[model samples]
Target: MGLWTVAAMTAGAVGAVALVPVALGAVGFTSAGIAAGSWAASMMSSAAAANGGGVAAGSLVAVLQSAGAAGISTATTAGLASAGAGVGAVAGRLIK
Candidate 1:
């Protein structure tokens, strides 16, 4: 895949990982785990964006985050992740 493809994948993965904390938190797993996991994911995305590799990342993140915000359940995170990866893969072709 091209660079953009990788960026999108990375972004999607970051967004998916971001959900882990929010998911566990909803399940009553509120503790250091949520804080730690969220921090890690956020830091990674921040770094990517700072490095100018966040276009695809942003695309993936936007899709997954929007999906979740639209009320898609964690029950669908896995499926969403797959879909997001596919989106990332095609992002280069679609956007360029």
Candidate 2:
């Protein structure tokens, strides 16, 4: 493809990747904790129920909660970036 196409794809990828944290926070997954009555709270409740009154370590709920309480790890960031890049590439092709 052209340089502009590549640039657009790269920009899209970066933008999508950057939005991950913001989106997570928007859904009540913040550094402090999951907000009461928020989507995150609901997920936690479901997870706790499924796991016998406790969220299991390494489970999806626990992992997301950890990420929210702290921040996504380098590996998670890389994985998100890769997924974003794939999405960007697909979108760019569709737009063209």
Candidate 3:
């Protein structure tokens, strides 16, 4: 694999890790939190795509939902979505 491949994977992993709280079934985040995350992730995905980046929409949404439902912060939601989108895009580019 190329360096980009590795880097992209790392980013994806980081984003996924951020949402780890959901796996445990309770993290104090509410439904609004998840919705916010999903919205942010959608925007992030669009932004990435507009900039000529492409990450699987399903994956992006899934990650954001998982993260949000797990109690992810509103303040950090945008940042996480952006980061995850970027990483997923990078990974898609490299792997493709």
Top of the candidates by TM-score: 2
lDDT of 3 at 86: 71
Candidate 3 lDDT score relative to the true structure: 0.57
lDDT of 1: 0.57
Model 2 reaches what TM-score against the true structure? 0.87
For every candidate, C-alpha RMSD to the true structure in Å: 13.2, 1.5, 13.5
Clashes of each: 2, 0, 0
- For model 2, how does the per-residue alpha-carbon lDDT over 15-74 read when each residue is reduced to its tens digit? 866887888898888898998989999999999999899989998878777888888788
Q: Which candidate should be chosen as best, given lDDT against the real structure?
A: 2
86 in model 2: Cα distance from truth in Å? 1.3
What residue runs in model 1 are displaced by over 4 Å at the alpha carbon? Answer: 23-81
Candidate 2, after superposition: displacement of residue 11 in Å? 2.0
lDDT scores of the candidates, listed in order: 0.57, 0.82, 0.57
Instruction: Write down the TM-score of every candidate.
Output: 0.33, 0.87, 0.31
Superposition TM-score, candidate 1 onto the true structure: 0.33
Runs in model 2 lying further than 4 Å from the true structure? none
Candidate 3 deviant stretches above 4 angstroms: 1-18, 23-70
